[model samples]
Target: MDAGGVDLDARRNTNAGTRLISMASGTFNASIQRVKAWSFADAAKTSPTYDWYPMYGMAVSYSGSNVTSASGKSISSPIAASFVQNYRTQNFKRVLFEYIPDVKVMIDSLSDNHDALNSHVIHGVSNPGAWITFTGDSAIPPGTIKGQAEGDTKKYHIRADEKTGEFTFVLPEGNYLTAGNKIWIYAFLNGKETLTSTIVEDKTPPDKPILNAITDKDASFVGSAEANSSVTIYRVSDHSVLGTTKADAKGNFTLVLAASQKPLVPYLEYVAVAKDMAGNESVQSDAKTVQDTTPPSADAITQFIQVGSSFDLKAKMLVTNVRDNAGNDDDNLSYTLLKKPDIEVVGKSEAVVEIADKAGNKVSVSVPVFVKDQNSSVSKEAMLQAEDFMVKARELPKDETEWDAFILKQAKARAWGVPAGNDISDNIIVTNRGVFSEKAGTYTITLRVKDVEKTIQAVVIPGTLSIKKIPSDIQFGMQKIRSFEQRIKPQEETKVTVEDGRSEKTRWQLTAMLEAPFKINEEEKLPDSLVLASKNMDGNIRYTPINTQGTTPVFQKETASEGLTEIDLNPAGNTGLMLDLMPGNIRSGKVYQTKIVWTLENTP
Candidate 1:
């Protein structure tokens, strides 16, 4: 083709007929049209035989006016042919393409992760109509298929919301689910799957903590709880925290209280609580009460006894009185003698008493005792011939008072001995004069040695009772008998003395009576009676007439009268004897004589 015509003929075709056609729609531009050309063998002879030739050219339209051949040949009516586009590949470049993007699912946050549960509801956001599935470990599967037997492979499935694209899945209810269970979730839609969510199930709290019984003022609290858990001790009265600690791997814990922390109050209640690492709290353990450990005071127990007093060790226990801080009364306490005292002997001794409270706490106290008996007795003979009952050895007691007591007891018991450091000859004074009397009777001897006063009975037994002294004769002076009356009294030599040496007092009597009437001769007798006078206990003068019928009561003792007693008949003082003479009764120069009888009786 020429340059002008070649510019118009932009494309070429190799097909035999209907050469200008597109291989496929949209494979190339269709606005540019194609045509085939025809040629004459000899154009000089118009009528010569012609041959058809394939021509290549361009056209603006497939319609009548723009259609032509390379020679500008036009036909009034052209046959239209319909065809499709076609092409031949020569060289090409490579390309990579994708039809859809990946889909992701997000799981919602869980509310409770440590509560024991049989089933759980899972929520997430996903595309509509997307299926959500759950997978777990071989030991614990998520769930069985819906409407399927329980033996089926465990899995849980659900669909997203049709409008909101939100989905929920309920984990199957079974005992197989346990703490720390793992679950892998997947969301599938349009053959696309996302494995971006995984859940760890922990639905159990630690076991309740255990607390041991404790006492007041304990240094630490010891107990057991879940491994690696936190344990706390609380006072039950006010719910105050006493101590806290973390449990070891073996579930043992010891909470040491700080120095500033108050000690456990006695008789108070306490409890323990445990919390696990998963933020789960356990119930309180049983109450561990605090007990009282203080015992009754040893100093408060006291015993008192005077020296030389007797005591019975087994009859009465010591330490009966004591004070306790725990409000224990005497009835609730027990007394035990740890050491017995020597009470039989009269000396100082020590005793130990243990006092115990209701809680079994005990305290010991030492008590001192002094033993003595104030009343004692001794015996001896009156006058001489008393036996010596005391030792004269120089050995003495450590205490001067005790030595004095020992010496005094011996002297009193045996009725003869001198006190230590006193004159040996003083025995005469002690036995005969001091505490002892010559008169027969029982006498009480009292001696004070330091804090102790002792009394001893010194008994004196009499040897005999007899008349010790009496006048040998009584002389009445010569007198003349007259016609008138006359009276004569005895001389000064008339008297009688009696001594009693008996241990007991006895009654006796002394009587004086005329043996015969006084007479100048047997025919002439003086008055046949004589008068004796004496003083009574009230110091009044009393007179008795002596007669021969029955003995007149001259001096009679109605009761016991000990020691020496004397009676005087001399014409002196308030006692004397008198003789009366009547008218013409006496003869001049005539001798008058009479025998006086004195009788002594051992009765009133």
Candidate 2:
């Protein structure tokens, strides 16, 4: 019946035979066997027991043995069953041992075995109070075992004295010895060593370090280090090692660049890498570049002529200033004078001027000199004399011709009159004496001497009659006229005769009056006695009306006695007259009047 390696499958198949045996024996042992088989299968599926089936099967087969089962089988499954059942009985006894007389005696005998569990008696049975006792190693002791019981398993905690290494426990009142029924104890030496009496189980992991921030050397630029606690800066272009730094207490670190580490060219790029305390690293930050470039400022220079003379060709100019960003005046500025045709050179007879300020700086200005003559004259005395004479002559006469003639005559007179011993006399003189007649006539001469000398001479002359008449107070009328019928006629011609008198040429002009309220008949005819009249040698009469064809008669037979002529009147019964005497120098008060009349047609 040693069923330590018994097969559960064979036991399940034998259920039918066991039922038949049970029926012959009038017992339900077959049902019990079926239930036990089912429990074994369930327990095996839930938490497999290493030797449970073999031990349980052996115990059931040997249950009817007389010598408390065979020693080998008893020691195997039956011993195990007996242990469970006795453990329950012992627990019961321990609970009521003091009250029950038999239990009291039974437990009293087992009291000594508590310290060292041994074989003992119980109520009418031999070797009844069998139990096992446990003591921990030198560092721990046995203790009251407080535990929770489930279907086939139990959880327990052993309470023990820390210093005495002792324990107290109450056994569970159960027929089955569970896997957890064994006494266990725990002890810790300086919280490091593992005690043989203890078992520990844990299923947890350690915590990881968290990164906060990353900063530069001066703490100027910072970035996130959420997963890293350290930083390193590197040259990305060549993967050159720059530097490394550790994170601070707050999981923050700084990265610094060395002063000697400058950009290779105009720009440089750097990358930041971070590693966490847990050895987790992050990708480098995006490359950042800095640029350095500067341009030069504008350069300018100006030059001018020192003296105000012409600047011809390249030799005449001088540089005034040289400038640049470096402000180095010692540096010579290059320049060339351009020959511009439009600019003139001053103080030069033939050439043109050219000047310039050229600094390779490209900014330049040029100026040219102009040449001019500086000779002129002014005669103030001559101009003043001529002007004064002209102004005086203009004021002398209203007529331009008269003023000119008078000026000429005055100049001639002044030329003729030379100095004559301070006495002024005419250049020509003439005198008249009695004339001599020719016909054997006698002549006489008388001469006398006194303070004024006198000389007289007489001679016989021929007889002559001289009638000279001088008209007095002769005046001319000023009138403007327009005529329709008969054009105006010149007035009567007054004649003067001279005979053997002191003869000298004397000229006279007669002035006539214009008679008004006169009219002329259209059909009137000239008398046969009327003749054509003439005045000056030219015979151009000023009294003749303009736009007329025939001459107007001076007198008709009927008006001859009255010395009058007919004149025509306009349709409005009005007539106009004008008389222009020639050779304007006339006597002052010579008066002449004539009455003239005419008949009007009075036609519509």
Candidate 3:
């Protein structure tokens, strides 16, 4: 039987004689030759060789079993077939011969127990051993690594170098590096972590402070320059404290100077210091020096004054030769006028004057003075005289009777205690003073110089004696008499008579009359009883006039008889009389006489 195509089960049960025939089938049959060669080649390389034919034949003869029976042939042939098939089915040619025995035993044992043979064969295969080499380890090296402290998480990346075995990290912009920070490098092989290096960031230093210089000329420092700064000023010579100021948020500073602290001395020195917010101090600027040595001066007034007949005093001031310590003449000086009580000023007589330094620095001052008349004495004297005359004239009496009584008393007092020889004997040189009639006489006084000697003559004479008749026989007209005499005594009486020749009938009447410029005490007493007619036996008179008791005297007569009329005589007369008359009766023979005389009596 050929092992290449033989079934193992059939060969195993074959007779012993058949084992040899099956084992030699490859060398005997030509057609089977190729199969036998293939089987032997496969069996010798893969399975163990055994003397199965001899062993099986001996066992069968000794048992005296019948050789020709179907069971014997079947067992012998199957045994040979099984040997061939086992070699063919093992496929152990790819393996070395040394492992062939192990393959057969595994296959025979699996066949006997009905187990799997491929599992046992695979278990015997050996693994190939290998040796590998790498360029460097994946461990991160120990060193310093630089990185940003505050940056984006994604931007903070680190990498390792293969050649140098060093790691590097990248940081984002605007992030500072700080100390005590760690950098990480990741191994992509197994996602393992490795720290690259420690970081040591640098610390920033503070900035330098700014320095500023401030002077009285430019005292104010404003805007950004004034911010984050401290200023201290000192007098340079003595190192005295001048002022100090702190800058505001906008870097502005303001310094106010007192009046006493102003650099009035001629050559003053000062120093300034400034410090910034970073605690840095600036270098001191150059010393600032100022002088104010000039004295205060006056300034002239700008307004004009108009001078007429009256003199007016105008005030003015002029400032010159005034200067400060810096040789500046522009310093302002003030003045004030000491006013006197009698002086008067015009409106807003006080004024203020301002003067500036050479650099146009200005100051203000005030001055006051009076604007008054210079010649006031002459006008005051003339006004005093006029006022005195008006006061004396207002004290006199206003009534005429009282005025006349006062004048008579003055004349009597002057005439008393006169010597008798002082009166001259000549008719024109009678006593210079006497009771003069104001109504009946014309009085004259004359002064003559004979042989260088002065003599005086006074004369008294009756005025023209003419009778005026009213309502005469020829015409109907009014009669009026105006009487005047240069000489008249005080309280004189004057009388006048009127005669009607028309049989004392025909009713002669009197009308309106007036006596002015003289006080006429009684005017109704015409044809007074003190006078009688040259022949009075006839009944020509009809009425007798009498004085009324306790009545103020009136000059105009309201009641009278028709034929004859009588009038009383009394007059407080000391002046001339003016009478206005009208025609009264219409008759041919009507005659009236205005006669005046005085009654003299001895003094008590």
Largest lDDT belongs to which candidate? Answer: 1
Which scores greater on TM-score, model 1 or model 3?
Answer: 1
Model 1 stretches with alpha carbons more than 4 Å out = 1-104, 110-119, 136-156, 175-182, 198-203, 215-220, 256-265, 291-295, 300-303, 307-346, 349-356, 360-366, 370-604
CA lDDT of each prediction against the hidden true structure: 0.54, 0.29, 0.29
RMSD of each: 21.5, 37.7, 36.4
When summed lDDT is taken over every stretch of 10 residues in candidate 2, the lowest stretch is 380-389
lDDT of 3: 0.29
- List model 3 lDDT by residue over 140-191, tens digit each: 1222323221121222123233333233222232233332233222222111
lDDT of 3 at 202: 19
- Candidate 1 lDDT by residue in tens digits, 1-604: 2121211111233322322322322222121122222222222232312111111121222222212221211111121111111111110011111122245777764423434233356678887766667666433344443412122242437777878889876554532334454666776553345777454545456788899878766788899999999999998999998877999999999999788754555678889999987777889999998886876774422333444455565412554445665554566577777777676653335677787777788888776543323332211211111223323222334465454345454554222111111122223323222444344456555543222233545554445567788777667778776777655687556778877655556688887777787877778887653677667799896767676666776666667565788866674664778766677767788778787777777773
Q: TM-score of every model?
A: 0.40, 0.20, 0.21
Candidate 2 lDDT over 169-276, as tens digits, reads 444322111211222322221111122221211111112222223212232234445433667666678988677776566555555545654322223466667665
List residue ranges in candidate 2 displaced over 4 A: 1-51, 54-222, 262-266, 291-604
